[model samples]
Target: MMRREFLRGTFGVAGASLLSEVATGLSGGGAVVAAPKSKITGGTIDLREFHRMRRFADLSMGRIAYVERGKGPVALFLHGFPLNGYQWRGALERLSPYRRCIAADFMGLGYSEVPENADISIPAQADMLAALLDHLKIDEVDLVANDSGGLTAQLFVARHGSRVRSLLLTNCDVDENSPPPAFLPVIQLGHQPGAADKFIAPQVADKNFARTDKGLGIAYTHPAQLTDEAIDCYFGPLVSSPARKEQFSRFLLALEPNLLVPIRSQLKEFRKPVHIVWATDDIFFGVEWAEWLDRTLPGSRGVRRVEGAKLFFPEEMPDVIAEEAKALWGVSRSPGGSL
Candidate 1:
């Protein structure tokens, strides 16, 4: 069944209205509504009471929307492009109680404020991440990153190595694989006038249109698994302003592998703990790269590969992420608690 149909069948009018309000609120002006229970692709995760959504101003960079939970040591999660902290809901639900879990929407994406000058490069995001940590008064954190977030994490750790206690990198751009083959053309299109809007806007505006070749359909292991809530959760932030479109386009345009050169040098001698959870079938970043990473970083404990998962495994396979998080951080579940 289509996700929209399932949503209508499951909650009828009230659910649909709540989703609309949340989406509207994310854009700019509307009443904020939190779901009692957020349904994943087909199931539900009880997140109503635990979730904390707020916006924090980062000096001159504008406000960044973030999701937070738990109360122990901080474990900050950085999401990739075209998505937000919403992607880490499952992990946040699982680990927040044991550790402070925080996930932020990158400056121009997700629910964050879209500044007139949207800085969306890897370095820019890394800078914004530092600002966020400072704003929250979090001096150090165990960092977890996936997809493009991994790249940003690399830059963040490289530039501000002291702030990171441990690092977890999932399937993402590494070395010379900044813009994967499938996304190269899309990134190229962003450089042109009005081209980014033509390609990016339609997918967000229409639900069914998002599940085709033009959108994120190809990135998922199975395109049919996408939910309307997920799409709107991601799309609402971008559709809210024209500046956000430019930000997305600029992020693609700024893809450069050379930027990671410093990270290689920094991570080589670094003694901090590092773990990897990779998707074996990811077309963008192959397992071979994971093998390369394991050997390069002195802190790398090991590499764990997940078969049959794709680029978006953090969301698609959140249980896997939680398991890996537990293993990486040596976290033990509390009595009767489960991920």
Candidate 2:
């Protein structure tokens, strides 16, 4: 079936937030591998020790690894590219005590197993997520997606919106603006033979790739704060082997043309609430895109910017993300977020 057909087939119109067309202008577009295993929150624990908490789920393609915590209605998190579910650690840690938080490693990215002949694209990721929710018998959830996962969130809602209780989107692809140009180099690396190796070597040899744009630099305004330990949590598993590199390359190459265009029309049919937490300084996706989202997604709560933060603002400002999530669920601070 075509993409729109799939979306319309899966979802029923739903009700839920806050944006009408913005009076402002806009632009738009929009990883993990890490080791030394620790929990995903705030980079405080040893990744090795933390990752011990991950569990796997059997899916059609393969097993998906995930970290589950807290209690209440489910709050599922979808991470961006080249990274695993660990990217959601900070927010998960904060949000879990109230609502259940489950962050999964996309098939093959972290502890998840890769299925043979996997499409490895945004739509596939959405299918995987839907399968996971169904496997677990979850009916609806508050969905929070970042980076490329944001695109997946849009597709999921378009096709299976009833599954989404609400949505929180961070800096990511919007409408026609996707795979932001700043990130084109990583995709280009996948096109050339041995080019991915050049990018991978520095990361493995000395973890020096963290200093490069494709590494930690492009995503953080304060890249210096991403200590070697923190960087290890983000890149180690991604470049764990040559096969993994090829897998990563295929994932990059899978960004099919017109992947997001269809969502433009479908989203108009969306009535659920949406909350946009963006990093204004992110060159890949600027405020214009956020405004476009505010205008396009009638459910939007309005866009909030994390001043001075870049792409990985979720990691850099986890508390803010958690708080925003709480507000989205109408949970207030004091003891913990409401369930």
Candidate 3:
């Protein structure tokens, strides 16, 4: 069944109203009233509670929106483009008990309030993350990322390797594979005025439309299950205002240049433990790239390929991420935790 239909059948009026309020509040930058304290059921996090979890850090770049849970050593989660910290909700739900999990929306995407002239390039994103860590007084973190976030994570580790205890990367740009050919059209369209709005606004309006191959559905394994609330949470902010659209466009345009090639030597020199969990079916970033990462990195723990999964599989299959992360940290489910 379509996720929207399921939501209607399951929640009826009040639940739908709550979801609407959460979406409206998050997208419109208004207040969400009477949000349920706990919105996690099974592994998914409710949009309302996800909004409530948001904490902003004011830096020179902008007000960075993030969410954190648990109490222990730090683990930072970086999401893919056109997505926010909300993508890691499932992983955070599962792994927060063992480590303090943080998911920060990048400068342009999600709820991060950046200036009109803010440099939302990948390098600037790396610098922003450093400033954010400093603001939080965190010396180091176990870094986890997917898609473009993987690219930023590599740059982050290259620039601040000492600050990262380990690394977990999913399907994303790597070395010469940076800004894969499939993404060229997006960069092209992003350079044009109002093009991003044409692409994203419709998806936000119709949950099912967002699941089409033309939309973000191509990135997910189960596109039909992509929820209405998730669609609004992910795309609403990008189209909320003219300034936001410009920043989102800048984010894509900035990625057109190859930023990863210059860091190849640095990546090779990064001696921290690195684990790669790649989705084989991802057209943009293939498993060959994962193999390339394994061969390139000196401290690589090797690559684990998930057959038939797409680019955003980490959101759908958080268990794989959790398992790889625990293995990388050498921790397991036990009463005594915090490694």
Name the top TM-score candidate: 3
Ranking by TM-score: 3, 2, 1
Deviation (Å) of 209 in candidate 3: 1.4
Residue 266, candidate 2: how far off, in angstroms?
Answer: 1.5
Ranking by lDDT: 3, 2, 1
Report per-prediction Cα RMSD to one decimal: 11.5, 10.9, 11.2
TM-score on alpha carbons, each prediction: 0.82, 0.83, 0.87
| lDDT of residue 237 for candidate 3 | 94
Estimate, for each residue in 278-331, the C-alpha lDDT of model 3 and write its tens digit.
776676786678888989898887877766567888888877788789888888
lDDT of 1 by residue, 168-191 (tens): 888887776766554565565567
lDDT score at residue 75, model 2, on the 0-100 scale: 94
Model with the higher TM-score, candidate 1 or 3: 3
Weakest lDDT window of 10 consecutive positions for candidate 3: 21-30
Instruction: Write down the TM-score for model 2.
Output: 0.83
**What TM-score should be assigned to candidate 3?**
0.87
Give the per-residue lDDT digits (tens) of candidate 2, residues 44-136. 434664577788889887888888887779999988775677777777777877688998887647667775466677778788989999998
